[model samples]
Target: MNVLLVGCGRMGGAMARGWNGAHRVLVFDPMAAELPDGAERVDSLDAVEVEGELAVVLAVKPQVFPSIGETLRPLAAQGALFVSIMAGITLTGLGDALGSGRVVRTMPNTPAAIGQGITAAVAGRDVRMGDLATVNGLLEPTGQVVWIDDEAQIDAVTAVSGSGPAYFFRFTEALAKAGAQAGLPPALSMQLARATFTGAAALAGADPAELAELRRQVTSPGGTTAAGIAEMDLNHAIDVIVQAVVDAAAARSRELAG
Candidate 1:
């Protein structure tokens, strides 16, 4: 597949790296200093050339769309499948801006840089099965791909999986701080906290058990794990905090769409 990737920033660069030897990728980002092997850099959108089907992956910032949306419309008119990974950019908005309804809106986390991210995608009104299949093929190299029927769910997906990585990182930082407060060396506390979280995530992925069940397995009736879990759950503090975080993110997503 031939791809035109816009804005080779962190996420765009990650996608470019994943697609590098697999597909012909043309990237347009004057600010990008370097690109992965097998990905060619284009000076401008007009410089892009394709013989067959083209997949234009938009990984630019949501705020940057307005400036380049017109420039991308020509490609969209040529039947290029548009896949947007920009946060809060709705399918309808993209379709309107690009003058093509064959658009896919996706939310991918930072782990995509390592080919372990989970992406949630929703098709625009005019997207056909073949277009979706092409998108799946293009995105598979980065990580897991989940297709959803309604675009409305994208905000929640963004709040959950899209912003989810930072949440885990923050929790790990907090855990390390707590460890330090309990007298462990700061560096050692951070090392343990980071490794423990990553190891637990690996176990979660390897095991088919439900997350709650997995937690239960580590929390004995009167064990240290149980005590920690109990304290965290006091007055449903963790639950409330998580809910608030997701709600705030989702709300901001809606605001961005407007």
Candidate 2:
């Protein structure tokens, strides 16, 4: 398959790097940055003169979509499948701008840079089964891919998976700080925090129940874990943290919609 990436910024560059061996890739970025050894780099869309059986990946900022949209309208009309990685832009919004029916809007997190990201995508009204198959093939190199039927759910997915990593990182930082306050050396505290969260995440992945159940199994009356749980549970700290994150992200998603 032939793939053309419109922007070679962080996300686009990551996708190019990850998908290198899977397809014939061409990158169109004005900066003239280095790409994978065998990948073709075109300075601009005008420099890209060939077209046929192409999958166009749009990694440009949402603000630039209008101008780029006009430029890409012809390509879309010519039968190229459009896949957008811009956040907050709905499939309907993209379809209106690109004048194409075969559009897929994807919300991919920064972890995609390391081939460990999770992406949630929703197809536009004009997307066909073959188009979706092509998209799945193109995204296979990035990480796990999920297709959602409802476009509205993309915002919630964005909140949960897209912003989820940063939340964990913050928790890790707090864990390290707490450990230091409790008397562990700073370096040791950080190391333990990292290891503990990593192991817990792995365990959670292996288990199918709610995380609260896992916590219960590890807690015993009059134990250190129980005391810590008591402190954490006081005044519904966990619920407040979860609601704060989800609400902030969902509101941001709505703001981006405009």
Candidate 3:
């Protein structure tokens, strides 16, 4: 696979590094930042003299799509499989802008930098199964990928997994603060909070049901864990927190779409 990445910002750079070995990757970013070793770096699309069987990954911002669309319309028309990671950019929008039938719009979070991200993709009307397979293969290096039949679900996916990491980090910080309030040393509180979440996440991944059961088991008769659970359950805190995060993220995603 010959891959061309259109932007080299954080997400783009992460995907470039993750997908480098899977194909011959070329990067085009105007700023000329240092690229990962072994990837070809070009200053502009004019420098790209090759064509055919190329996978074009659009990592550029949504605002730059107009210029990029004009520049790549020819290649896109020639059947390059277009994969876009720009947030809130719909497949229909990308297809209209790029004049391409084979397009996949994806939302990938920062964890992709370390190959642990979860990405959701929606195929355009003209996307074929083969195109999807190729996109999946290319994205496999970065993390897990899921396909959605309804494009509308992408917004929910964005709210959940896309912005989910920052929420976890915030909770971790709060946990650390609470620990400090309980008189633990600052460093120890931070370490405990971080490690607790890490282990819990790992366990949840292994057996989510079992982890829930473990939580129940740990809550003995009128114990501290039970007390905390009671408070958390009193005002439907968990539901409120979950809904608030999802709503805020979805709203932001919609705003970005405009």
Q: Give per-residue CA lDDT, model 2, range 198-244, as digits (tens).
A: 89988998899899899889999899999988887899998898988
Best by TM-score: 1
Worst 10 residues of 3 by lDDT: 43-52
lDDT of 1: 0.90
Q: Residue-wise lDDT of candidate 3 within 1-258, one digit each (tens)?
A: 789989888777877777767688899988756987667987778667564589899988888887878788877767788999888788878888888878999988878877888899989888888898999887886789998889888888989998999999999999999999999998999999999999988877777587669789779979999998898888899889889989989988887776
Prediction-by-prediction clash tally: 0, 0, 0
Clashes in model 2: which pairs?
Answer: none
lDDT of 1 by residue, 92-129 (tens): 88988999999999998889878899999999988888
Model 3: lDDT equals 0.85
Model 1 TM: 0.96
Error of 3 at 106 (Å): 0.7
Ordered by TM-score, highest first, the candidates read 1, 3, 2
Q: Which lDDT values do the candidates have, in the order given?
A: 0.90, 0.85, 0.85
